[model samples]
Target chain A: MKRNVVSLTIAVLFLTLAVTGVMGFFLPFNILTVSVHALLGFVFIGSIALHLKNNFRQLKNYFTSKTALLVILCVAALVAVILLQPKPVLAILGLSKNLGPAADRFELKDTKMIYNYTPAPHYKMQLNFKGGRAFDAEKPPRVAIWLENTSRYHLKTLYHSKAPDAQQMLPYWHYKKSEYEKYKAESEAAEKAGKKQSEDVDALSSATPNESFDPADYIVPKDPEKETPYRLLIEINAPDDGNEHYPDQPSLVYVVEVDNKHPRSYQVLDLVGYPKSEMDEEEGEIEWSLLYADGTITTAHDLFDSALLLIERSDPIK
Target chain B: MKRHFFVISLLMLISVWVFFAIKAGEEKTSYQSFQGNIFGTRYQVQYHAHEQLDMDAAEIQAQVEKLLQRIDKIASTWKANSEISRYNRAVAKDEFQLSDELREIITLSEQLKTSTGGAFDIHHQGEEIDVSAIAKGYAVDRIAEYLHDELAIQNFLVEIGGEVKARGHNAKAEPWKVAIYIPPSHSHIVGPRVTLSNTSIATSGLYFRENHIKNAETGHAPDHDLLSCSVIHPSNTTADALATALYVMGAEAGLAWADQNEVEAIFIKSDGSIIKSVQAQR
Candidate 1:
């Protein structure tokens, strides 16, 4: 009975360790995976320890003769395998020592981590609400509160995912994909006929670029059904006089109106959502909600363009 | 009989020790590489060592190259005889059969696209979201699997482009030293150092790639005001995709998304300002 119980315990412990170790892959960001893996590791160690203790007499007998040779060989093989394991793990994870193991082993203590990668100052800004009635239909449908680049250089285009209701297809999105084929055909015909149709086509295509930026370039589906969020593509250029930061900025700023009933025209100076001190600008995307009369709150491109949109939008190459 | 058995066992131990000791002495370094062709790009794997367990350099490189070629054959925009090329050209619209590589990348991309709200879209046309940025990391992972599972490699580092992964310690018993190239303006690689081990790191800023993050879908400066974005993730694919997406998204949304996802990222705004993830500093 004791022998059977011991076997059952050994089997249970082995099963538990294996199951926990395998579960580690899916629960990568989850802390429980680590805990489970650690627990399993302890169980494995304990199992081996107890088993070795129980087999002490057999181990002694084996060591006295050829059995010892086989045991040593098995251990050597296991060691080789263990030693060989790390390379594949690193490769599979695309991990290197440069990134440091602590990143995976631990999480950042505080959520307010920051760094100084760039050489310039910034006007970090944020508003107080979530994505609320910010997308209410107003004269100009509201987006997150933002500022205008009135900085010196010519304006450039900007792109981002907007709110669900606020999402509007740019004029370009109206064109059926067949339009590209038609344009391509004309251009090709012009090339074959030795005419200036190519230039004309290029001119037509480049027409809206200098004046209006289209948001279709950064289109992303809200769902597989094809609904998408609002995005604005801006185009601006600054002369490269060897400046590190561009003087030109987004000529336009679209802020989500706070009033669900009457979203107001959002302007930078009127944007009191973020603390004045944090309202510095370099060039990046940031989410800003309005505390307007409407109280329309929304997340600004919470995903793709969120980071870029997290900072102020700038046009110049800077 | 007992004495004979003892003598044989001792000899066996000595032989095992001699073989391993010699191997250990000869094993100075190991590396991992990926070689494959996808989207007209040829990828190759090389240099992963696991203390002399099934070390075959040429074969691993060949396998990686073969996988790359296979991907090229299936990628819808792979330029030539590649499957993607036909799909993009509208010639073989029905030929959009997804291969294993395509399916894997697409699945990963779709997951990221939804999670990041299209910030890291793999299906993005115009500059076409090439998985190249993240493929290296995947290749590293694959190489690791091949070595550990197939060949039993234990200690090594793998990298392609600027992304990297490493395991175990170097000859001096130190973690692998991966060097990050400073922005072109800087004279050396001294600034903005991030030390890592047993993890993957990737940078998707225009610092490299000839600043090619323009929006082909809109003929506009896609990365307006954003210089670069580097993301580090437990998964290299996530890091790579996020890096590119965040760079394309520019600064604001990049930082915002980083904050939201609890991801460690660093963004360089167009004006040369850097915004780092709260997680990265820690």
Candidate 2:
């Protein structure tokens, strides 16, 4: 009776282990499958021990026989092959990983898109442009927002209307952008030739001129700071609404100077000037001379009823 | 005496087998972790293997980053030159051609919008389509697939921002467990926990920030009593969109929608009450 019980226990445990192992292999990783397989495997060892003890004499006869030696040799060979981690065996195991439900495949490719990876700014600059009576949704006016240093050097473009004729619509911004690009190209060429570039070009290439102007590094100096105020500019132009000033009305530029050290809650932009329509023949560039809005400026001034530049400062002093 | 020797030898063999088995289980317990930043948010991936992993941890992380970068290039609205941005800026909306990836995402978004009764919409304020709500979740699903299909990583967890997808068992040979955090306040109080195996969980709410989620019809942030809503699904993209939609739906309507759709979800009310959908009760 004891031998029968031991034999039956081995058979039952072996059946459970086999079932759980197969389930664990086929099914997605789950606690039940793994725990049952691992825990029952230990129990199976105990049952096998009992079975061996119950039939020691029969097992001894079988072990010394040629059949037992052959079985042992076969088991050893299988273990050796698996331990070697051959490519074919690994590939088979890899296939088992995908035995679960199929995943959604994305045929993604590199889109060579140019992305601006600028660091998050300390102050949030929200530009609120209210469309005036002249502002038409059908023929929306092209607008460009950019930042410049106190000395009128172009710093960066905050926003630009994605119109094909954006350059013609915002000539003032286009001229500044062209100037910046030329400087940037010259600096790059000089750097490639291992030549010491001009100090102005080097300053232009850096994110900001002075260390204090670095928005990311908010290091408060003990002494009263001599901070440089940056100018925010916006250029707006309406197409096909030509006024008496020119066939295609020149773009209007708005300017606001902001001091980082002495931050303000709100700063209204002042109507600055429009870039001269004619290009300078000698310089091969659009003349920097700006024309003030006059009687002919008419509907172009009404493109934006009001422009508010709200700045939220993250400084401790503020 | 020979019989005793044979029995002892058999016992020794059993002992060796048990020892090796225990060692293998131990090996599975020690997991390798990889973490990085993507989509202006942090992400983490944890996985384990019974045998040697085919790729190094760094190499796998690089591949994951590359995959995320590609997705960002296609879908990120912040990128001025991205495919989605181009579509948004296009004068003729109908004429604008979308890439296969963007088209698929937009189709999924449209289906979600219909299913949720316009509570979830990517088209915002005429001609603008923002997939910010579902893009992260889609990215999470993509990474999970990459790990499973490309690397053959069976046991892994991928989390980007608050969106998460887990598969198989963890290093401890147990189902992956994730915690859902409630918003507004009360850090000490543990909200809820979800056991994920081949599933995802996404939570959306106005927590520690200004209200960014707006009603699709009204074009303004919805006035609601619920603080946060979390959804669990096999696909992280679906879970993500549902979370945002449920938040807009509030607790009552959200619960009803979740039950009808058989979506497992948990909603935390403003007055510190928790509500679970019928499926989530499990």
Question: Over the stretch A1-318, how does candidate 1's per-residue lDDT look in tens digits?
Answer: 255665677788778767765555433334675677687677667767777777789888879998789989999987785455454533443322122212212111122111111101111222222222212212222222211211111111122224353222222221212233333354344233322222221010000001011111112111112111122222111111122232311112323212111212222222223111122143342223222322221222111121122222221111
Which lDDT tens digits does candidate 2 get at residues A50-142?
888888999999999999989999999998976665656544544442222222111111321111212222234566666777777677778
Highest DockQ, which number?
A: 1
Assess the local accuracy of residue A127 in candidate 2 as a C-alpha lDDT between 0 and 100.
64
Give the residue spans of candidate 2 off by over 4 A. Answer: A1-318, B1-30, B49-52
What value does the lDDT take at residue A165 in candidate 1?
A: 31
After superposition, the stretches of candidate 1 with alpha carbons farther than 4 Å from their true spots are A1-318, B1-25, B29-48, B76-78, B90-95, B124-134, B215-218, B223-225, B268-274
The structural similarity of chain B in model 1 to the true chain B, as TM-score, is 0.73
The local lDDT score (0 to 100) that residue A225 gets in candidate 2 is 35
List lDDT for all candidates, in order.
0.44, 0.71
Minimum summed lDDT over a 10-residue window in model 1 chain B is located at B35-44
- The CAPRI-style docking tier of model 1 reads incorrect
lDDT per residue (tens digit) for residues B42-95 in model 1 = 222334455555546766665654544454346424234454454455544445
TM-score of each candidate structure, all chains considered together: 0.39, 0.47
